[model samples]
Target: MSDRNDNKPQTPWAKNLAIWAMIVLALIVGVSLVSGQNSGSDGTVIAYSDFIEKVDEGAVESVEIQGQELNGNMTNGQAFVTYAPDDPGLVSRLEEKGVTFNAQPAEGRSLMGAILIQMVPLLLLVGIWIFFMRQMQNGAGKGAMGFGKSRAKMLTEKSGRVTFDDVAGIDEAREELQEIVDFLKDPSKFARLGGRIPKGALLVGSPGTGKTLLARAIAGEAEVPFFSISGSDFVEMFVGVGASRVRDMFEQAKKSAPCIIFIDEIDAVGRSRGAGLGGGNDEREQTLNQLLVEMDGFDANEGIIIIAATNRPDVLDPALLRPGRFDRQVVVPRPDIEGREKILEVHMKKVPLAPDVIARTIARGTPGFSGADLANLVNEAALLAARQGKKLVGMAQFEEAKDKVMMGSERKSMVMTEDEKKMTAYHEAGHALVSIYEAASDPIHKATIIPRGRALGMVMRLPERDEYSYHRDKMHANLAVAMGGRVAEEIIFGYDKVSSGASSDIQYATSLARNMVTQWGMSDKVGPVMLTENQQEVFLGQQISQQKNVSESTAQLIDAEVKRIVEGGLARAKEVLTGHEDQLHALAGALLEYETLSGDEIKILLDGGDINRTDGPKPRTIGPATGASAIPKAGTRAGRSDGEPDGAVPEGA
Candidate 1:
C-alpha cells in the first residue's frame, strides 16, 4: 500500500533497451547522411555559359539546341544540364572539331533534379516534425504526458481514511476547516438560510504543521472526493502550457465538484507579478493568471474549495489572496506545548513506549518542533529501542530522538585533540551554567563537547512542561545562555579566536535581542517601540531587513543594548562557573575523557559526587534540582549508544 501510494498516478517509464538501440542507430545514420548531403548540395549549381544564353530571353519556355530542347538553370551565368543522351554512343559522336551547338528550351523534364534537391530540406523538416511527434506520443503513452500533468491525487470516501481525529495539533486551523467540512456534509443548511460556501481557503503556515493532513481530514470527515496537487505541477517548459494545465485542472475539478482541491505550495505559481524574478510571461505567471481567472469566475455552488500551503506568505500574489479568490487564509503554525504533547502522544500510541515516557516533558524539550518533528521523534525512539532489542522505548531514547530531530545525530566518533576538546567542553559548560543559574531560564538537560551534526559542541536546555507563553526575561535569559559559550571562551582564553559553531546561536540571540528592542519593546533606550526592521544581513548569502526609522546614535544604542544583554548573561555565567571553579575543572576533565557528560553526571559532580556515575545510558536521571530540562537526553550522546540518524526517531529506528 505504501509503495503504490508513494509512486502514485502510475507514470510507468519502462525503458526498452532494444528500442533505445534502434534510436541510437537511427541518429547515427541520419547524422552521417545529412552531413554528406550538405557537402554535395550547398546551393544551386549551374553550367556558366549554357544558363547565361537562356537568361537573355524572358523565362525560356523551351530550349532549342541544334533544333532539340535542353533543360538547366541560368544561375551564376551558366546552365548545367543533367541529361544523358538516348544513344549510349552519342558522347563519341558529339566531339567533331569545328561543330558548335546552341540550346533554346526543353519540355516536361526541365529542372526536375534541381527541384528534387530543393525538396531535400522540406523532407528533413518533415522528418524533424515526425521525431518530435513520436517523442510527444511516447510521453503521452506513459501516464498522460506531453499535455499538462495534474499531480492532484484523487481520494474517494473509501480511500480517504484520515479525519480530524487523526490530526493532533493546530486547534485554530482545525476549527476553520471544520466549518468547510460542515458545509460539504450539508450544503443546503447554509443555502436554505441564504449563505454561500467560501469559494476558497488558503492554508498558510511554516512547513510540516499538518496543513496537508488537515486537507485530508476534511476529505475524510466531509466524505467527499479530494484532489491533491502541488503548485509546482502547473509549471512546464513550454510557454502557455501552465495556463492550459490550469484550465484543464479546473475543468476536471468542476466535474468533480463538492470536492477539495488541495494545492501544496501555491507560492510557486501565485507569486507577485512583475517581481522581475521570472519576468511576467514565465510559465508560473501564466498559470497564476489562469488560476486567478478560474477562482473568481467560478460559481460558489461548485463546492470545489482550494487549500494552499506555503512557508512564505509574503511572496504570494495579492490577487490570489484577495476577496473573491481565497476568502480566508488559515494559519497552521508550529504547535504550542499542549498541541505538541498531543502530537507526541498520537505518534507514540502505536509504539512500544514505556508508561513513564512523559509526552509533556518531550514537548517542552522541543520548543519549536512541528507535527512532523514529533512524528519523526516517535519513530526514532521506536527504531532506537528495536535496534537494541529493547521491549519498550524509554525516556532516554525519546530524549536522544528529540536531539536527533533538532541538532542532528550526535557525532560521537568526531576525534578532537585534547586542547580543542577542552575548549569546547568549557564553552558548553558556560551555557549550561548560565541557564541553570538564571532565574527566568528554562532547565538545562545536557551539556556536551561531543560533535553533533554541524556543531563541535552543544548545550541542550528544556523549557517548563506545557509552557506556551514567552516572557521578556526568559527570552533574554535564553539569548544570554547562547552567548555564554563564546563568553566563557573569551573570558578565559582572551578574545583571540571564536568558531562559528555559534553562528546559529549568535543569529538567534541577536534576533531575540533586536526583537526585544523593536518587536517585544523590552529595551530601555528604544522605549517600548517595535523595531523588527532593524534586522540586517550579518553573513554571506543572507537577507536581513533594514534597520528602519533611526539614526547613527540610535543604531549604536541598539547595539549597546544587545551587547549589554549578552554581556550580562555571560557575566552571570562566568560568576556561576568561576565561583565553582573546582566543579568546572572537574566537569571539563570528565568531558576530556568521554567527550560528553549527561546533566545528571555533571550534577552528581556538582552535588559533591553523590550519585552513581557508573550507571551508564539511562532515563531522566536529573531531577527538579538539576536544571537540565531543555536538553534532549533521548538523542543525547550517552543514550542509545549511537548517533541520531536522519532526525527521525525510527521504531527500532
Candidate 2:
C-alpha cells in the first residue's frame, strides 16, 4: 500500500506546495546567516554614568571595548553592556579601578551576509527569464533562437484513429485519394508499370464537406507518418521568416520519407501574387515561392507526398495547381439524396433511434445538407429526446429539430394584436394559394401563421428532386409566386391598408427578374449577350481601373426589361387572386384556427372536406416547382408605420 501510494501521480496543488516550501527554507537559511554575525549582543544594557560609577566602585571585573560600546563581567558574576561618551580618560579610569579590558572593532554585517542579500534579486530575474523562454519553446516548437523552425506536429494514434470506414457521403473523393495510399504502401507495384505517383492532390469543396477528414483517411489507410500544419503558420511580421519556415518544413518531411504532409486552407499563403493595388505581401509571397520550389524544384522530394485542402480554389496561385505540383483535383460536393441517406445512417449509429425514425424520409426532407449538417441534426434530435426524458429519439423529435434548424427557432413568446395575426394569415395564404394553382411552381411543404425567425408568417416549399438548373417557365412561375403575398394584401385590405411585410418578396422578385434579363438572356430585347460583369474580389486592381461593361443605352434597356418581367408576374398574380378570392378567405380562416397546417391538411381544407375528420381524403402529390424555400420578412412587429419591408431569400435562390 505504501509503494502504491508513492507511485500515484501528484496533483498540481502538491507540487506547488513543495516549491513554496523550498523557497521558504532558503529564506530561513539566509536570515540565520545574517543574524549569526551579531550573535554576542544578548546582555542587559546600562547607562554611561552608571557604568562609570560601577567602575569607580570597582564593581567591573573585566571589560572589552569595540568602538564606543563596552561589554564587561560584573564583580557579582553577571554580564552587562554600556555605551561610553567621548571620554579619552575612560580607559585610564578602568585601569585605576583595576578592571582588565581589551579593544576590538565595531560590529558590522559579514561578507557572506552582504553577498546573499545582493544575489536574491538577480536569481529571481534569471528564473523568470528562463520560465518565459521555456513557455515560448513549448508553444511554438522553438525558442527565440529557433524562430524559423517548422511548427508542424506529427499526428499520433493515441486518440481513437479515423479510417476510410468512418467516411461516407463522399465516395468519389475517397476513391480518388485511394491511389495515393496504394502508391505509398507499395511503390514497387506502380514502378513496374512505369507510372509515377503524383506529387500532390488538392481537395476542393464548400466548407464542412469533409475535406480535412478525407486527408486524415488517406493517411490512416497508408499507415504512414502524418505531419499536419496550417497555411497561416508560415507567415510572420519579419521578412524571410515565412520562407525559412517553409524550407525547414520540407527538410523535416524528407527525414520521414514516404510520409504524408497535410496543409489546411492553403489559400492563406498560396493566393495569386502581385494581384493587389500595391503589389502584394512580401513575406507571404516569399513563403509561397519557397513552397513552390520545395514541391517541384530541381531537387525532387521523391518519397514524400503533399495533400492540401481549400474552399477558395479560384483565389490560389496558378503555379501551385500545375500538373507537376498538384496533379489531381478532387471535388467533395454536398451529398445528394441517396448520399444523404448514407450520411444520416453513419451519424444515426451513435444515437438510440425509435422504430418510426426513417433515414430515407429525413434525407428527402434535407435536400442540400452536408455531412456535418446531418450529424448536427441527429445530435439535436437526441438532445430533444433527452430533454423530454425519452428512451430513444422519435420521428416527432427529428421533425421538430429539422424545423428548428431550417427555419430559425419559433418565436412563440412574441406578443401581437389580433389585427396583426389576421394580416399575417392572409399574407401567407396568398403564397400558398398561388403555389397550389401555379403549374410550374413547387408544392407547398407547409405553411404557418405563427411567427418564426424574423417573419410573422412563412410558406416553405421543397422540390420533388434536387434541381441543378431552372427552366424559363419555372423561373416565371417563381416570379409570380414571389409577388403573390403583396398582391393578395393589396386586394384584401385595399392598396392603402397594405402592410410592409412583402418587402422581402419584392426584393426576391426584382433580383430574379434582373438576373433573367441580364445573366440568363431570357429577355428577347436584351438579346443573348450578358449585360452584367462577374463579381470579383475588391483587391484586384482591374476592378478599380476597368470601364463599365455595358453602354448607357444598353443599361437603360436592361432596366426596362427587368421592369417588364416583374410587372408581368405581378399582373398574373392579381388575375389569379381576383378569380379565387373565396378560396383565399377560406385558407386564411383555417390558418387563424390551426396556427399551422401541413400540405395534406391545406388540400383537404381547400376541397371543402373537414380537416379534423379521421377519414379525410389522402394527400395528392403536386408537380415539381422551382422557388425559394423560405421567404422571411423584417417588419413583423405590429403597428409599425415603416414603409420598407425587409425580406430575405433562402440559400441558392
lDDT of each: 0.64, 0.77
The 10 consecutive residues of candidate 1 with the worst lDDT sum are: 620-629
26 Cα displacement, candidate 1 (Å): 26
TM-score of 1: 0.64
Q: Write model 1 residue lDDT over 1-653, tens digit each, in one string.
A: 11223333333233334445555565565555556433323334444343443444332332224213233333233433433334443223333221134444443433554565556566656666555555665522223345664546676545637888889879989999999888988888999999888888988877788988888788778766677778888887777878887777777677667777888888888889998853675777878888888888644436678877888789899888897689998989888788988998888878887877998877777766778877888999899889889998999898777667665676645444555655766666667667767788756666655444444556666656545456877776776676666666665666775544354455556666776776677887778876533446555677655655677787788889887776665666667766766666666666556545666766776777743446543321110100111233222222221332311111110
How close is every model to the real structure, measured as TM-score?
0.64, 0.73
Residue pairs with clashing backbones, model 2: 441-625, 442-625, 504-647
Best by lDDT: 2
**Candidate 2 residue-wise lDDT, 95-118, digit = tens:** 898999999987565666788767
Model 2 alpha-carbon drift over 4 Å, by segment: 1-143, 365-368, 373-400, 494-496, 524-529, 532-564, 571-582, 613-653
